[model samples]
Target: MNSTLTVSWRSVQLLRILVSGIFLVAGLNHLIEIEKTVSRIEAAQFKGFAAIFGNLELLVILSGIAMLIAGFSFMIGFKTRWAAIVLLAILIPISITIQVGQITTLGPLFKNIAIAGGLLFFILNDIKTIKKQKL
Candidate 1:
């Protein structure tokens, strides 16, 4: 590849790492605050399953694991696009439900949108590569 292309690739990989690292840190912290986290979820009026959400210690653990794997893939630029898409899929809805309408805080809402945009960048760029591979 040309030098310009190589630099562009490296920049994309760095962006992916930065985005995924945020998810990894947040997910790991969730483990330490499962009860409080669940309470917050409950407070958000997530609906129809308050008790189930309160007991989501296991799910919190799994989410942390997913974030770590996704973060590593992003950092290494291996399946980077797939990992970003997965991260966005898992985060966006939860962000909207918990942070957007409920919180109404500028920081949280904008952060979510920014992360979503980052994942979209990865996905769209990679889709072009994927299409080439398919031909």
Candidate 2:
């Protein structure tokens, strides 16, 4: 008697699209509001981390490009695990550098953590399909 609840593939696709939404919007924000993103990074409590890369603008541009690419890949469900890995790679440090310090930012911090958990769901499971595989 199999009893585990099963999700429809359409629902899984919706999850993928929803999970990628933040990254897609954020990537556009980074490109469209480059100055805004930079100034926020500049004012971060651990701002000195920028010194490690030297050119803050260049770093922001690269990250924005990466986010756009990874987010697209994630939404389309192509190479989903790799997309999750790429997103997680960029997300963890950005979360620590900006969102970890301020009480006002706590909501966003937990949001990033939740995003990581979503990505991890892909990372830990072979999610190509919703149906069970034959042994």
Candidate 3:
């Protein structure tokens, strides 16, 4: 490979690390501040379906755990496409439910959209890599 390609690859790796680190810390924060997270979920009025399987708190905790798993998988480049998909799935609902229609939350809503876009790009790139490997 060309030196320029090598540099580009390293830069991409660093970008991946930076993106994945955000998720890791967010996941850890959810776990560490479970009560606060659950309170936020409740404050957001996430009750209906979330209450079906016991309480909204449990669902929030489960989502946090999923976030942690997906974050780690993405960071280590293990099943990266699947990890990206998982993160996208998690982000979409949270974005809609928690980050929408508030002046204070507009930033978070846009941030979630950007993250979802990145995850989608990651998924497409992984598919292209797989095709190349098979060729």
Best by TM-score: 2
Residues 11-126 of candidate 2: C-alpha lDDT, one tens digit per residue = 66778899999999998888888899989989998667664766778778888998999999999999999999999988987887788866575899999999999999888777
lDDT score, candidate 3: 0.71
Where's the lowest-lDDT run of ten residues in candidate 2? 126-135
TM-score of each: 0.73, 0.86, 0.77
Q: Order candidates by TM-score, high to low.
A: 2, 3, 1
Q: lDDT for model 1, on a 0 to 1 scale?
A: 0.68
Runs off by more than 4 Å, candidate 3: 1-7, 45-54, 127-135
Write one digit per residue (lDDT tens) for candidate 3, span 1-135: 633211244444555666777788877878789898777766664434344456666767777898899989987778888988988887876666567634475788888888887788678774333322211
Name the candidate that leads on lDDT: 2
Q: Which RMSD does model 1 reach against the true structure?
A: 6.4
Instruction: State the weakest 10-residue window (summed lDDT) of model 1.
Output: 126-135
Question: What tens-digit string does per-residue lDDT give for candidate 1 at 1-135?
Answer: 643222344456467678878887877777777777666766774522434444455655666677777867866778877888778866865675577655646788788889999888878764334322211
RMSD of each predicted structure: 6.4, 4.1, 5.9
